[model samples]
Target: MQRAFLPSFLLLSALAAGLNEARAARLVAPATVQDTIVMRLPNRATLTLTVRDAAQLRQLKNYHLDSLTTRLATYITQAEAAAKAGTTNQVTMRFYPDKDQPGQNLPEEIRITAHKPGTDGEKGPTKTQVFLNKKFGIVTTKDGDGHNSFSIGTDGNATANAREDSLKREKRRRSASVELGFDIGLTTLVNSSSTASLQVPSYNNWRSTYINFGLFYVQPLHYTKKSKLAFTIGPEFSGNYIRLTGNDQWVQNGNRTFVETAPDAKQIQQATLYVGTLNLPVMLRLKLKNKEDRTTLSAGIGGFGGTRLTSNIKTEYRLAGTDYNSEDKISGTLNLTPWTYGLQGEIGFHALQLFAKYNMNELFKEGQGPKTHLLTVGLNVLGF
Candidate 1:
């Protein structure tokens, strides 16, 4: 009977022990910062977790926040000076913390200090001071502290400084891959058809075809491994020609009002002229994905304002087919000059290319019978 009672008591004790262990496992301590704080233990010494309101809890979580803040602050100042070549007057900083490391246990503590380019002690510590509190998990330090300090484990500054140095090294690698290229292509005009039965009553109609060609040089303002921005300014020359046709019209203005023995109407003759222009081009260029073997497409729009540097027109009468040399017949004062403005687009494949341009401005003078539209399609030698 005694042996049986002993076995029964031992079994009851084991059952009670198991129930208590389960209850303890279910009871979790509430975290002050987390609305739903979950503390996980990955092993004897590590933790895995997530934090959503790190910024709101920054004051309470000053140590980690300070680590991120100091790292960002150093990066901003150094990056700006590097970008502008010691020309940056001010700096801005941002902080990003590890969201997956939120638990009662922390790894290490660090403090970061910035030194001038050459000297270690001349700056006399960092320019600003940071203070932290662990109980509230916040940065409780006042602004009066010239130096800021955050406490997690102790090596926060060293870690932050290492990252800042890495970024500086990367920026140097990109600025070395920049280049500039020059290009030139021919521009030609297409002509319209003329009819003999449609002779102008007052003025002769004239038309001509011409070609212009030029070279351009561009320089890169900024260059990185992947992108480049450039500015181009250059001059161009154009050759022009003109063709003329004859026109005449007769009208009766006088009626029988004066009874002057049926007055006859008189016929009037009219003339047309074609002019040529020489232009200068100025433009800006931007290229993206500047890889060695990659195909890149770039577009540029510019205005070419030209002067009537030269002019030639040939005149012919409709009835007699008589050819008249109108080249010297019209003076610069009597003839209208040609001026134009255009926009251009280009697509590049590897080092080969295709280009197109449209002239937005009218090609003819004010009173010309028909309006002209100039379009150019060609290949770009410079694959930029």
Candidate 2:
């Protein structure tokens, strides 16, 4: 009888030792910020676990060891299963301390939730809850709202979503845009022939006005992330008015052009010439700042070439100085060039733009009239 009892006791002792070894194998050191725990699930998926605070660290190291690990492993399995099934892989788990033992040195209630992929099969948002004290807890999520009860996904996808959003905004900003604007400028004759007797319009009496209506298509040329420069090209209708002093009218005799007092006119009041053209303008516009506010500084330089559409001269005179009521309107090409080309520049602060233009081509055909260039200066009333 004694020998049989001894054999049973030894067998029981051996079983107890095996149980102790297994328990020791499962135990681990408390988690710290420097340590990251990685668990490989049965489905060949990985779950990375982290401790956010001291209380969480203590709970992970001590209380409900088997229960917590089992729950986490189950969550990992479900996430993988959802991924394979093409469904939402989100999982939420809530933990609460045992209510029966109020004085126990155990952690308070906590929640862990993982987000699922969005419609595009990418991870959505994540949320983690940590109890800092018995009465307070901290919740964090990729979205600003932290009060959400469930965390849907992992944090690995937050950065990708942010990058996608940024790209979309940039694409919208770089899109092509069209704008309408009006241009007005002062004009004068330049680079005239020395031998020509045609008097240059006096600065005091010669009033040059350029009025243009245009539609511009602008494309942004990005040199840097914050830099803004644009290429602009458009078509415009321009009407140029030049008022010559005194009652003089421009006349063309064969190959010579001259200005003289209008025939049968006494005391000329006003003599004006109008030239209309259709212009194609190209420009480079630069902004000193990235913002569109009116306080920013901007500059532009460009050139234009076009064909003259019409030309006319108007004369107003005083018949023997009797109230100066006579008026005459004439329409002709006046030997003006059929085509025109010029260089233009603009500078402004915000919406106010000042412009200047220098015509490179002669105002009239070769040997047909006085050789003169046109210069224009004025303001752009409708900012582009």
Best model per lDDT: 2
- lDDT scores in order: 0.37, 0.59
Measured against the true structure, the TM-scores of the candidates, in listed sequence, are: 0.35, 0.55
User: What ranges in model 2 sit over 4 Å off?
Assistant: 1-172, 203-206, 223-226, 252-257, 262-265, 290-295
- Please give, for residues 1-384, the per-residue lDDT of candidate 2 as tens digits: 224333433332332222211111111223334433444333333333343343443333334333433443454445435544554445655565444355653335545445554443444434444342452332333321212221111132332344346545645655678989798877788888644466555532236688989899989875233345889998999888877765576555665555676666377777777889999999998866554433377789999999999997777777863763777786777889999998999998766789988889988777676678888888988755
lDDT of 2: 0.59
| Model 1 lDDT, residue 5, Cα | 35
RMSD of each: 20.3, 16.9
Give the C-alpha miss distance for residue 223 in model 2, angstroms.
6.9
For all candidates, what are the clash counts?
26, 7
